[model samples]
Target: MSHKNKKISSTPKHTIIKALEKAGGRPKAVTEAADTGSDSEDNSSPENLLTPKDVIAIVTKTIQSELRSIVSELRSEISELGSRTDVVENQLDVVSKHQQTTDTEIADLRAEFSTFKDQLEDLENRNRRNNIWIKNVPESISAEALPDYLEGLFLQMLPDLSKESLNLDRAHRALRPKPNPDQPPRDIIIRFHFFKTKERIMASARNAQSISYSGSHLQLYQDLAQSTLKKRRDLINVTKVLRNHSIKYKWGFPFQLIVSKDGRSHSVRTPEQGLDLLRRLHLIQDSDPSTSASPSQQKTSAPTPSWQKM
Candidate 1:
């Protein structure tokens, strides 16, 4: 036997006997039999005593139980977070779709508005086709006699025109009130019953070079919508520059001014285009004062073109 076996064997037999006696209601004979059995067992047997390996096994099982509980809680939290992330992603998808829809609607509205504006402008221009504007005529006649007076003036300006041949419709001054009492009277706007009659009068006026009544320099021009008139006025400077350079140019339909040079023709719609042509032709030098002025100021310094004299 070794020292460890001796130590285990040193446990008092009386202690074992007392433990058996403590078993509930055991007879004295049964307690003595248990003590005899304990004495007969080999004291060196390892199964009868607590050991380091058994303690380590118990601690390991306790730690494993706690670790399993922690892992389960972490898994549950991760599952909840994943669900919330899915909801956020879905919300983002809906917002993106709504934004796309709004952008599409805005584009559709803009396209419709642009088409409607073009149609309106076309209608307005068509209404003025058979009309003419006469400016700088003295307002000696009353409104009631204005139509007859205009017809008589037209007959005087046109050699072949007569009262029977001219088809008069209506004649009146501009609609707005005079800005100043001393300002010249508003131009007469005349609508003819026949488009041909309006064209014939305009041609005769061009041939006569200058028309005057009551010593006032009267002028005849085709009636145009205010928008078209503004665009043409904006190009007045360009026309003057073109005429000065001997560049053949004419006003085309719907507010286009076409210029022909070196066997090639270019259409201009804005003052910038005309300035570009002038720069290309070397007609406008970089140091010129008109080059730095606004388009309207440039026209003030340049002479009026023959075609636009009226």
Candidate 2:
């Protein structure tokens, strides 16, 4: 085929004709004559062709339409994700608030329990104020005979005590099963009608060198709450150290052990504190064990002097 007759393909002819006119090298009459010949030829032929400018415009329009659809889909997805994030944040806030309220309620309950415990302890101590514990008295004495026996015992032990001054109220053993056949009976607990009478009895007991009934050695002690009794027991070693050193000391009410040395009194609450004080006074060696005194030793020991009433 001749070079002029060899036609382009895959492009519209008018597009090429317009491009030729815009290029201005081809005369306008020649471009118009080419367009007329192209229109007269078979329009369905593969040789029909378009210009580069037309191709660029068509591609740009198709790309723009696809981008618009993609953008619309992305916006919808983003809106749904934002709504889900807001719901999750709201749920987290509710959970945090509930945890705070639960913590506050637990704190309140703990405070209330502490207050109730203190009040209950106070009541227990108050109930024991006018009572005394007597040990080594024979279990043979019946409860009905206890008051009279105690009165007579007091009168004999305490020279200043009178029958009318005794003011006895009630007496009984500890609230527990009787001891085994081989073991001794429980201590007798006595309650006096008056605190003054009880105080007098305790003072007399303290001043006495020894107390006995039916050849059995008897001991007297204040009827204290179990907690207070345990605390006092813990102080037995401290008491022994003071006594061995001739250091004056006494047990104050509600579990305070007071030691007087060089005219200065030191109050001790725990066994550790007592041991510390004794170490400072050079009364007991550091290696000494702070074991409580045995029952027999405690009974035989002299009462602590300079007792103070609280």
Index of the highest-TM-score prediction: 1
Candidate 1: minimum summed lDDT over ten consecutive residues — where?
301-310
Q: What is the lDDT of residue 200 in candidate 1?
A: 87
Q: Which stretches of candidate 2 lie over 4 Å from their true place?
A: 1-122, 284-310
**Cα TM-score per model:** 0.56, 0.54
The C-alpha local distance difference test score for the whole of candidate 2 amounts to 0.71
Alpha-carbon shift of residue 172 in model 1 (angstroms) = 1.4
Q: Give each prediction's root-mean-square deviation over alpha carbons.
A: 18.7, 17.3
Candidate 2 per-residue C-alpha lDDT over 280-310 given as tens digits, one digit per residue, 9 for 90 to 100: 8887677775544345433343333432222
Report lDDT per candidate. 0.69, 0.71
Q: Give the TM-score of candidate 1.
A: 0.56
Per-prediction backbone clash count? 0, 4
Candidate number achieving the greatest lDDT relative to the actual structure = 2
